[model samples]
Target: MYQKKVKESNKNNIFKYIFEKRKSFVINDIAENLNITFPTVKKIINSFLKQNIIFERQKVGFGVGRKAMEYELNEEFCYSIGILASSTKLKFILTNAIGKILKQQIYELKSNNCKAEILNSTKDFLNTISPEVRKKLIGIGISVPGIVSEEGNFIEFSSKEKIVLSFIEELKNLFHIPVLIENESNLAAIAEAFLTRNSIYSTFTILTINEYVGISNFHQDSLNNTLFFKAGRLHHMVIESNGKLCECGTHGCWGTYVSDKVLLNDFQKYFPSIKTYNEIFDLKYHETNIGASLIDNYLEHLAIGIKNILFFSNPEKLIISGNISIYKEYIADKLIEKIYKNHIFYRGKETIVFSSLNENGSIIGAAMFPILDKII
Candidate 1:
């Protein structure tokens, strides 16, 4: 019995390895990469083929030897829905087994009518998906900003209550599949780790700067237990003892200085017509004085926040995501330069990077949970 269980576990690991690669692999490639015997790898591949969990693709020529058959995940074999609930919008995405997004829909949300809007939008999205895709849906994953209970049954959002018990219950009844909910920042970090295959860093910190600021730490491809909920509440962290007031009723919080809203407010004063962070970034490239000044100050405050994070966590890599990452080249370079210039402790060691997943990291990460939960 123990041997049987071990074999089953190995099979599952092989299956998961293929999905994570997100590409075709031959029997020898799988065996060598996963450190399994060729015979065992072949057996697992055949079983997966028979189960319709994976399928063969065109053969790839290997030097003078006969072509080797490549196998890839049968993406349509299963699907997942990911919903990102923000203060202003609800973004829904459908992803296949390999985490490729098949379809996406967004609906504007109202503070007062959030519950009704979400239910209606979700139903509309469900109706629009192809029947074939819906039939294969394994589960739904919801990503909400702010803290989620460890059990994922409760939420503590900074904005209005977008994801409540009633909403969760309604979704479960409607879908009748496993539903996973997680904090947006945590999901973003997970997405970064999974999508990059840990190429970025096995352990790092992700800072999301949008309407609100969010921070989460990932260690060895997983969330660090020490940074959960209250500990990871970076937005409320006091950067200034007597600084500007924050919506959280705190003075000198990090969010007040670096969030998109704050940046926009400062930008609007100089160029009232300029709308969107993208435009500001574009203007900066033109050497506009106002644009340069705004970005300089933004980078300075951001550097301060990052320095504080380093003081505590000292993460080897820092990933900046959300609205700011859209200007990855500009923001990352400036932030890195500022950190190196200002902070003596992290002058040359730490690596600062941008989220390769961009804005979709949270939604994609959330969508992957349903499939990941079963595999991992």
Candidate 2:
């Protein structure tokens, strides 16, 4: 038993080192970095190659007569499927072990509360992937807006299996592998942090604005979701305490000011024909557009919530995600000026910017969860 545990530990540590490096490594490099025995590293590499988890990328000379084989994760074999289940949309993202997206698609949800419909749609979506790719699927990752346990289910919200447990099991049966789920905000934080794996700020906070507002703080090396209602509650933070009414029957929630509903409701007034963020923001011009006209008020409300978040969490960095990022070109500097100006509680050294991954952050992070499980 002791020998078996040691071997497994050595194998995991070595694999994790290689995975985090995100580069090709020789057996010596793996052994040296992880302090594993040369023989143990060789044995594990053989197992990984046979399992098709890693492959020999090439041979590198180490100043010796013979060159050593370079090994790296086989991106083709270590793939994942991500599903984002939300109120109005069921989005799917396919990605490799390192979160490089292969393909993604979105479909409107006929009924958000219907579990059977969601599962059926998922089966149909998976069937769309090529048979060859399916054979290589390592696992399926799920992202939901509700708060969930680390085991990745919405049980905490309702504490009932009916809501999402069976759905996770069906996915496990589908791939014969792990099916992990988590709060979409946590996953978004993971995706954003991973993208900046080499960056200076490892501890940070990220805010996403869409149909609602999601706020997540990521400390270095942490992927755990730690909020009561998390971003959902951020929507109801009551910046104004007695302002605009919310769909949840509340007033002055930060979401009431900046959510898609805010713009959607206003846009419908002018261009009743159009109904999505894309249509509104992608118009030929926003200079005289309703969407454009709503900017100042939107930014003011947005900055207030942002200032509150920074003052409380005080993360190393703050990022804007979701459709809100689409306006980065127009709002980045303007938004920054508003947040920093006349702020007494906020101390500087907090970096604020927009995510390049923006809209795709949740799905990409969801798919990468299964990949991250390999090392975790």
Per lDDT, the best of the predicted structures is 1
Candidates in order have lDDT scores of 0.75, 0.70
Segments in model 2 whose C-alpha atoms lie over 4 Å from true places:
1-8, 57-64, 149-167, 170-177, 198-202, 220-232, 271-275, 289-291
Error of 1 at 296 (Å): 0.8
Q: What TM value does model 2 have?
A: 0.83
Off by over 4 Å in 1: 1-8, 62-68, 151-153, 159-167, 197-200, 221-231, 284-286, 346-350
Question: Where does the lowest 10-residue lDDT sum fall in candidate 1?
Answer: 222-231
Candidate 1, 92: how far from true, in Å?
Answer: 1.5
Number of backbone collisions per candidate, in order? Answer: 0, 1
lDDT of 1 by residue, 214-265 (tens): 8877655233312222216688888889998987787999889998888888
Query: In candidate 2, how many Å is residue 170 off?
Result: 5.0
Q: Candidate 2, after superposition: displacement of residue 112 in Å?
A: 4.5
Candidate whose TM-score is highest = 1
Tell me each candidate's TM-score: 0.86, 0.83
